[model samples]
Target: MQKVTDYFNKPLNLLPNYFKKIGLGFILASVVFVVSVKISGIHPTAEKKEMMKIISKDVVLLGMMFIAFSKEKDEDELTMLIRMKALASAFVYIVIFKIVSDVFGIIDQELIENKNGYFFQMMIWYFFVYYSAKLLR
Candidate 1:
């Protein structure tokens, strides 16, 4: 188990310098997908809308995951610590956001309907927060 954990923890230079671009591309693709769905002349059936939602969610999540796991140019103890801190911070923020959003949902149904938007926002926040913490550290 320890060996498996260690292996999983290893950051491969596999992503190199292109991780950010690839992640950004995924994010953009997610946005474009939603926009296209909205603008398409065909009235979206319930199943189609659901499918699009899942696809968009997957795209955003994949982008964020790519960014999160990507190897930095300088992979050092300090960078790893910063990454861990950012993850902790993002988790806390997500919890708080969810609670607040839930409270707002009691006041407005629209808030509940837009729950997926919160997920997308959280992914973006995680990506930015990781870099921001690194820079600030």
Candidate 2:
């Protein structure tokens, strides 16, 4: 049990702090592009629109991954613990959300079919929990 705890407590090899800024830039650019397209009302063919959605989702997910794995300005044992806790909390939250939604038929079937949607939700939860924890500390 001690060994298992130690293994779980090991720090991840995160990206450099600068990558966080890069991640933020990616997210911001993706948002700007999406907003501009919506405002311009350039309705492409269905296929093209679907492709655009896929591309935008991929970009956002990539940015989120970069942010999730990036190092903090002052990485330490407490930070590592907080990160672990946040990730676990996010995972549990997503699982419960999925189960509840399925049981209640609250969300669209298409959303449940798309794994990326769940991933996006999880990332959102992770950031929320992480920052909230940091602020409280």
Candidate 3:
């Protein structure tokens, strides 16, 4: 463990095109292959295309997160506090929306079609609250 720590303390250089050099290509190939098989409607395949779709979506999300996390910025205490408040406000909106949906469901189940859209609405609410806080501050 000590040797490992010592090694990590030294500066290290990554090989060029490390993601390409490693097995990411294999992952990409499998994603493509499975999708093609699904499109061709081959028999004896146990809906592996669904799994491939999920994996591909996860890869996209991971790639996006790399870009998001790579950006460097500084936030002051007030800005951090405002962000927390904004998040809390969004959570409150989520709870309220859920309660309203449940009430509507009791009244009529068809009131809320496409329940998955609630996530997108919540995201919009977060930004609304965040900017509202900034303006009020």
lDDT per residue, candidate 3, 51-122, as tens digits? 665666556444432322221144355755676676688789988998899889998988677575565466
**Two-way lDDT contest, 1 vs 3, winner:** 1
Ranking by TM-score: 2, 1, 3
Candidate 1 achieves a global lDDT of 0.77
Q: Given candidate 2, what's the lDDT at residue 109?
A: 68
Model 2 lDDT-worst window of ten: 106-115
After superposition on all CA atoms, what RMSD does each candidate show versus the true structure? 3.6, 3.8, 9.8
TM-score for all predictions? 0.70, 0.83, 0.47
lDDT of the candidates, in the order given? 0.77, 0.88, 0.60
lDDT of 2: 0.88
Residue ranges of candidate 1 with Cα displaced over 4 Å: 1-17, 36-42
Please list the residue runs of candidate 3 whose C-alpha ends up more than 4 Å from where it truly belongs after superposition. Answer: 1-74
Q: What's the C-alpha lDDT at position 125 in model 2?
A: 96
The candidate that achieves the highest TM-score relative to the unseen native structure:
2
Say which candidate scores most in lDDT. 2
